[model samples]
Target: MVYLDNNATTRLDDAVLQAMLPFLKDEYGNASSTQHRMGRKANEAIQKARIQIAQSLSASDPSEIFFTSGATEAINWALKGVAERYTSLGNHIITSQTEHPAVLQTCAQLQKRGFEITYLPVGRDGLINLEDLKSSIAEKTILVCLMAANNETGVINPIADVANICQERNVLFLCDATQYIGKTDTVNLQNIPIDLLCVSAHKFHGPKGIGALYIRRKRQPIQLETMIAGGQQEKGFRGGTYSVHNIVGMGEAIAHSAETDWRSIANKRDYLEQELAEKLKHVAINGEQHDRLCNTSSITIKHVLSSELMSQIPDIAISSGSACATGTRDPSHVLLAMGLSPDDAKCTIRISLSKYTTDGEIEQTIEAIVAAVHKIRSNSPTWMLFEKGLLD
Candidate 1:
């Protein structure tokens, strides 16, 4: 099957699997134990993986990185941990309407606890207005939570600008970098003044159920209330036994991503979009005018349902929206936030690529999409009327 849903999860790299094997087979020991050689070896491996992750993100201190099950858990830890800790300073949080449900739902939970949440709106291009963000920061605002890149549209937000604004305001900046980490140059994070960042390994050719959160230690370290309380793992911030094999896989995957040729991947993504546009009329490229991720293309075919189109091309693995929101029947909240009508949102499909994606796969995906869209639209009376200039 031609897989074009890398944003949801990528295929694990061979190197990553290779790195994980030794840990899974022989080096199985609790990283929390330090009395025995086996436990010491596991602990040493975890520390090495932590350093690899820290260096990949240009973090000066390895201790600042905290491992979690995935971006969702990291996001929860970042948002809830800050809100609980800083309640004496402020009770207000700022975020965008197009954030992943991880952020949005956490904000909702905060609102239940009487913490005010300001959800800034996004434009048609799925980018939030920095001005709106600046004006929303009141004296009670303690955190500004924003995503670095959108999962569905792949639109990169002006995170550096948002970080600057938050820094100037003295409010903590939390960036959900799950979609941005391996796809782009996140190494410049050292200079960005962001306080907290979240990333998932599965988004970058690593194993699922493993991710990291970067907490800037040099910047007047903001203390977070511990979410899980038991062991001293992750500097007592998170409490759990480390998944040694998964951590090793994450480290190897990120190391491999650093050497990948992203420009070629971008070119393949562009070619697929170009082919789709040339072959299909009434095709709208979502967030086309904005700076987006190199590997994603969110397309909307007029009068065609994305589910129906995907059903027609069953061999091509794609997503109508985010994998997290797959079972929900509602239109994509990200598209809805970007001013797309429910019908337009329902008709949208997100095609994301990875380094493993090939030119042959892109060509096959384009042909399948064009054929599927044509077949679906041909049966639509709305498409017929629009084609004949009788409907707008």
Candidate 2:
């Protein structure tokens, strides 16, 4: 099968699995207990993995990093912790409408607590206007939440600008970097002034059920009230027993991202889009006006429903926008926020690549998409009108 839904999750790398086998088999020890030899070894391994994750994001100290179940959990902790900690200062938060459901839903929950949430709108190219963000900050605004890169459209936001604006206003900035962290260099902390960041290891070829959150403690320390309160695990950041094998695998996976030929993958992605677009007419690419991820393409075939096209080509693995949601009638919230009509949103297909995606697979997928779009459009009334030279 041609796997192109990498934004949903990546295939776990073999090298990462190999590095975790020792921990999964014989090195079972509680990371919290370090008096004994086995416990001490596990503790050391976890610390080393933490340092690896920290360095991957260019964090100054490993203490800024802590474990979570995934990006969703980390986002919840950051949002709730920030809102609770700064309630005396303000009850207002700002975010974009195109954020992941984790952020949107958490904001919804916070609304019940009387905290005001402002959702900034994005343009048709899936970018939040910096001017809109600047005007949204008020005396009551205590936090700003945004994503580094959109998952479905793969359009990168202006993080450095967002950080500068938030810093000048003295508001904390929290970024959801789940889809951007290990794939690109934009998540650097020494440069961007992001106070809190969320990441999911599985989004970058690491094991599932493992993620991290970076809390800035230098320059201007960010103090968040502990949300997951229990024992002193994670130095009071989180409360849980360590998943040692998963942590080791995540460390290897993220550290190995530097060795990937991402440029080659980007070329393959561009070639696929060009070939398919030439073969089929009335095709448009979402986020074509802005810089996008090297390995992503959001294609919209007019008069063709993505559900119908995918059903016709069963061998190609792709998503109708957000992780297989286009199969239903409800359009993607991200696409809608980007001003896509419901019909166009339903017609959009997201093809995301990874290091494992080959040139031959991209070529084959291109041919399959061209054939399927033609087949699906042949039945569309609008396509019939276009073929008859009755419509432009």
What is every candidate's alpha-carbon RMSD to the true fold?
Answer: 1.1, 1.6
Query: Which candidate ranks first by lDDT, i.e. highest?
Result: 1
Worst lDDT run of 10 residues, candidate 1, spans: 184-193
State the displacement of the C-alpha of residue 92, model 1, in Å, after optimal TM-score superposition.
0.6
lDDT of 2 by residue, 102-147 (tens): 9999999999999999999999989989999999999999999999
Reference-based lDDT, each prediction: 0.90, 0.88
TM-score of each model, paired residue for residue = 0.98, 0.96
| Model 2's TM-score against the true structure | 0.96
Candidate 1 is scored at a TM of 0.98
How far residue 98's Cα lies from its native spot in candidate 1, in Å, is: 0.4
lDDT of candidate model 2 versus the reference:
0.88
